[model samples]
Target: MTLLSMYFLAGVLAVSALAVDFAYLLSARNQLQVAADAAAHAALYYREQHDAEDAKVKAVAIANHSMPEDSYGAVLRAEDIEFGHWDYDSQTFTVDDFSKDAVRVRPGRTETRGNPVAAHLFAILNKPMWDMTAQAVFVVFDPHCLREGFVGDKVVDIQSNNGYEKGFCVHSNQYVSVNSNNTFEAGTVVSMPDSDEIELPRSGFESNAGLQAALRNGYYRLRILNQMDRIYEDLYWASGDFLPDYIASAVPITVSQKKLTNADLIPERVHRVNCGGQALQIEAGTLLHRVVVVTDCAIRFGAGVILDEAVIITQSTDAKSINSASDLQIGRDDACADGGGAQIITYGGLEVPAALKFFGGQVIAKGNVSFSADAGGIEGASVIAGGTISGTSNMTMGYCGTGMDDNFTVPYFRLAF
Candidate 1:
């Protein structure tokens, strides 16, 4: 009976030891997963501005920082980091040396790496040592609104005689209200939270061709204006200004007393103007090229003003933060020129001119956007507003993917494993 009790005690101790080893294995796996996730995210971010080789180096550094080599012994190797494209529909990742869309990181504490997790009970039982690896796939994507379209947070109300070109997208967080005699070309997308929630006239379907077929139901509640602060801060720092109020306290930029012209601005330098609650009115035929203008007041453009490779930002919340009277051209010509486009970011509403032409340009407003006249011609035109997008008769716009480099795109990251 005493020998039987001793055998039972030995069995119990063996089971307890196995259980402890299992728990330790789980803890080690969690640590490796954390390190891999961090490494993948850091690599993807670095790949935005660098090549795959540089990105791999960055990943190894980040992984080693999380798991020291002396303790974990090379959990993540530079060769194990891969740049690739992740297909959402297929749920697969394909390796691509030149792709910056996704990054895959494999971190392990395995026998091959000479750091296999020790298993005392398993070794005593004549079992294999613990060999584990953690995989992380991090991806980056741009929002549809920034891709090329008109996105309104509140409502999108369009009047009669409006024409949208191919690939032109219109989305509203709430609803879209449209009047009669409108044409939405093929490949155009009009989206909202609910397709049935769109407001239309009695003969909406019959009056507008492709309107019924173009309606899509989706939800995108991106706070796009929040990005303006980062852009503003970046421009401020790039201008070599240490103080936030340095540009705010400076004198107003003018050419002839109250007016501004080509001579008033230097294309190579960043110009900051303190309007002091007044307007910064540009003279007629003023050609602003390769410059950045940051101001706190409204901007009024004279007739026939042109912008090429330029950026105009206003922090005003007035009714017309950026207003044009006669006409405004946003590029060098009809064909898109490399490094020749313009972008306008305003905190208030945008009052578009009679003929708003765009070879490649973007208008981002924190408030509403009122198109008083026709806006067509060329390509690469995007209008994003936080409020409503109303007014307009006979409006047309195009999308040029490569020509929109001057425009800003919102980026986001996610971890998929």
Candidate 2:
């Protein structure tokens, strides 16, 4: 062959060799891209489950699955792929310079680039293996999402009986306002606004016997005097050292009454009580200590369960504190600071199986607060209710009142794919 012809042939052969290498690089890039995608998805899944180590292992496994495994060096070559976090602004990834010989995966710093498959296709003429790195990101699912199915009432009214205190007292971390025509008393020694406005109906003192009878007869209208009023009420009467003559001429009147019953205070454990097959009954004076964790459980009371402490009811557990004559009090405990010290945290919704009779006490519902019964079933006696009622699609209500019409401003998480 002539010298010119020989030179032309050599040029053609060089071009052909470049094309072959380019095709091989393209195939490798495509495989790497597949590996990266699989690794990223796997890592994300693991993070959602709160398992970081497992996530890494799964990611590696996915990378291996997407890599070639026919040759003796196939497994080793696939292991060269690295996975990590990519910082966009930093313009880098967890793995700065990964290669078939150096397969070290970096933590908290992964570089993100155009698809690995595209990179391989472009690496035909120069550069070793392209930058084929994988990254994963995940966010936790907020428990708040579980609160999206609550429905209930807001305003409640409790009438006063002879000398019985009317209305109720409420303490909340959120805003609370009273609109009912009743008296509100701060049960504790600490004086609160509007305490004086809430007083007994006739005598302005609690008629224990009459109140008991009313409760038993299902007539929650009987009012009791707000004894705590002495600290706040200016009209309180105190007759002491009556003139000697007037005291001597007075006749003694016979007064008989039944003793008040103390509630069963159960400490930090789960208890199953009957709600008269109505909803779930928690008799008055019932105390739950510690956190009462429940699962798909319902607590219905004949009168209502007086929660002197915090009660947490999750989706796995359903809790209902329904009373006929008194308000369902939650988060009241001696350990509680200035407030009633009781907290009712619900991951699920609250159902007032009957008319809620709010005699007294505050409610802090983190979930939805709902009333299903009519006046006959539920009545808003002298009660102060507040808390967020969340139900579906970022929807929330009454984060601070008895009604489910307010919005919640608490921080929450969102689960994603």
Candidate 3:
């Protein structure tokens, strides 16, 4: 009986050891997995705001924080982090030197030398060490050109009964509301990143193949738009020696009286064009050659206002209207090589007449941009607005597709699968 009791006691000790050791190992594995997941997510977000190397560093740091040194038998290291893309078909990951879309992280592993988790009880069974490894993968998503046409940062309201034509990408940052009777052409996609307040007809707003093809193939990204201030100055505006230091502070120059003289333009200073809070009206058939500036005042382009590679900027604090901005022959004869295209930047809303027609140019504005059907619509033009972009009557405009560098970039990064 004494011998039997001693054997029973030995068996009890082994069971207790197994229970404790197994629980510890399970808990440690869960912790490592959590760390890996966290690291992958952080890496993707960091890649969005910065370059690739920085993103890897960010991921490693986040993973290390989750599984601190000595928290487990092994420590998370930078070598455990990897950048790559995933193959969904094969369910595999391939490392790449140039890809910023995917990030992989391994929190803790016995693969590292001198870093094996020591088993407290399992050693009695000729197993003194255990290896633990956990991994996670995350991918990033980006949009292409045919995916955008009218992108508003705040609000978008379209009540046009005539509908939208093909080859136009419409995306908004806030909400998109399309009223009744407004149809859509083939290859036309209307997307909003923030709210799901999209109101459009499902069964063919216009009943065309082009519009339907766009809807079937295109995708949407719900995120904040990237800033385009630098692109506006560098790509769209005058560059190199033609780039000015600053336009001096001067009263508004008007062809209202006569053609602008040399006194109207300040040579060698191109960055600043200052109109001292006064309205500027370019008389009918007047020719403009340099960048023009206006501050909190109306800008009226009279009949046949011809621009010889000119750019105009109007900034306003109050809500004032831009009167009779019509009948302009801008950047047509020069072939748009000097600056690629004539440009217009406005801070306030534009109230244009029916005869508005712009050729080979672009408009970047902070307020609503509206065009009328009384005259011809835009041709080879890219118009960007901070608010609504609409026209009261049905009009035709050809924006088909511009260079990606031409559009304002709103960098949005997100996890893909």
Steric collisions counted per model: 1, 66, 14
Decreasing lDDT order of the candidates: 1, 3, 2
lDDT, candidate 3, 1-417, per-residue tens: 999999999899889889899998898788778887888888777775577778778877776677655654345666777778888788788998567768777766584545667778998888888888888887764364322355556555655554566665566566566555555666666666533455555543453334333442223342321233443343224442223223332333333322233445443223333346666565666665555433335577677666544565555533343555556654443322333345556666665655665555555666777766333445555556766776544655444344222333344344443
Tell me the spans in candidate 1 whose CA falls farther than 4 Å from its real position. 1-101, 107-134, 221-224, 237-257, 414-417
- For TM-score, the strongest prediction is 1
Q: C-alpha displacement of 30 in model 1, angstroms?
A: 12
Local error of candidate 2 at residue 3 (angstroms):
21
Residue-level lDDT tens digits of model 2 in 142-248: 12211121212222222322122222122222222222222222221111222333223454334323222222111111011111122112111112221111112
Q: TM-score each candidate.
A: 0.70, 0.36, 0.58
Query: What value does the lDDT take at residue 296 in candidate 3?
Result: 37
Q: Which candidate leads the pack in lDDT?
A: 1
Off by over 4 Å in 2: 1-41, 47-52, 65-124, 127-129, 141-263, 269-280, 289-298, 312-326, 329-396, 400-417
**Superposed Cα deviation of residue 227, candidate 3 (Å):** 3.5
lDDT of 1: 0.79
